[model samples]
Target: MIGDRLKMLRKEKGLTMKEIGEIIGVSDAAWTKYEKNRAEPSIESLIKIADYFQVSLDFLLGRTNIREPQFVEEANIQSEFLKEFEWSKIGDPSQMYFLVENLSTSIRKYNEHKVTELELQLLLKTISDVVLYFNTLAELKEKYKSITKEVLTEHRKTLSQIIEDLNNILEEAYKDILDGKK
Candidate 1:
């Protein structure tokens, strides 16, 4: 999947393998191997490739067909009301993106016979729970407008702690999933 995307992107730019290799500081043969799926680039190299192409890591990894990052889309909002809203803070898009990548990895493992159906289901459930909790926290903050200032402040503090806890849970889950894969 990655190899195909790399080849396509390289061709789209009218770049030869050697040219791209020089740009990425890798040998032409190594670049060819990546395109052929015979070798995978290190995470550092992957970042370099994505950066050089001006594409998102998700797109380079074949996790999304969309070339633009979600944040880019968010930044293009034209409404003044929406522009004032810090949507990214309410639901940390970076965390969501990381979760998406983990889910994609789990699905791919399941498809490749690397993980059991039950494992995949558990991962899906964990992800669903995290999203539900995170969104609920966001909703509570926005929906409690009539509450006393003191109460609202306390709620906000509590909500922030809960969000942090949820984030820790997600990070641990992601580590567990990747560790299990290894």
Candidate 2:
């Protein structure tokens, strides 16, 4: 799906693969593979392409049909799982908490040359707001097995109003750090 979207966007702009690759600081072959879906781009490269095309990442990924970037739903969790959901010790929520907890540790290590800035940023956005919502839902599901669909729908709306995407979260975190709020 990404390959198809990438090819379409590239053609629409009348740019050759090589030209776009040069613009994005990637090799022509690498760009070709991306279009062919033979190779997966790194998250940074994905972000770069999304920004370059002025298209939302979800559109490129075929997760949504919309093209506007800001309106992109970074993640969508169906209120109902395909199968019966079960709580796990290594669930997404726990992993998200682990990631947040280790953020400071990563920064300390990076200052001491243990990790790179790339690693630090990746760690920070590892769990997007959508993921946080899903994990919260999962926790609630564990406790309220009989919750009605209406309640879940209302909860989704409430969460969406408050939580922003991982990108925004990173931006806020950076602001907090710079403003001595971290």
Candidate 3:
């Protein structure tokens, strides 16, 4: 599967086996062997090939039809979490796609605006925090499915604290922007 996919991607890109070998830090003979499925690539080489092809390992391995790699801190845990939850039932799945698109747009705008290093750093940190906040919520949901009143209260408190911290960061960021404009 990996070999076939690799060959297809290379052909699609109009690259020769030698070019791909150079790009992936492998010899041309090794590349040919990979294409023929005569030799298997090491995990590191597989990752390099996947990165070069901008494909998911699962897709390359034929384990999944999905091409995009999932971004997660813990793939095994998240896969289990995903199996138990239907996120689309809670909200439109398309909204998540838009959320990612919006983040990319936001970063592009920030770059275009040529924001100061401090502001860019703060924005990046806040983005990281937002991801962490959601992960925390998911973890909470996964950990305590029973959701007793006490547990619910604790979860609310935790979420509220995180929100407050995020708000503080945003306020400081806004203040910096306003000060810069003044």
Best by TM-score: 3
Candidate 3, residues 77-169: lDDT per residue as tens digits? 555655445553766655655665676676676778844445556666666766776776677778878766756776687667667666765
TM-score of 2: 0.41
By TM-score, rank the candidates, best first: 3, 1, 2
**Angstrom error at residue 130, model 1:** 28
- Give candidate 3 misplaced runs (Cα > 4 Å): 71-79, 82-182
TM-score of each: 0.41, 0.41, 0.44
Question: In angstroms, how far off is 73's CA in candidate 2?
Answer: 4.6
**The 10-residue segment with the lowest total lDDT in model 1:** 74-83
* Candidate 3 lDDT (Cα, 0 to 1): 0.74
Cα lDDT tens digits, model 2, 34-63, are 999999788899899999999888888998
Could you report the Cα RMSD, in angstroms, for every candidate shown? Answer: 14.9, 16.6, 8.2
Candidate 3 residue pairs in backbone clash: none
Total backbone collisions for each predicted model: 0, 0, 0
Q: Of 1 and 2, which scores higher on lDDT?
A: 1
State in Å the error of residue 62, model 3. 1.4
Candidate 1 lDDT over 118-172, as tens digits, reads 6566556655665666676577668766556755666676567656655654655
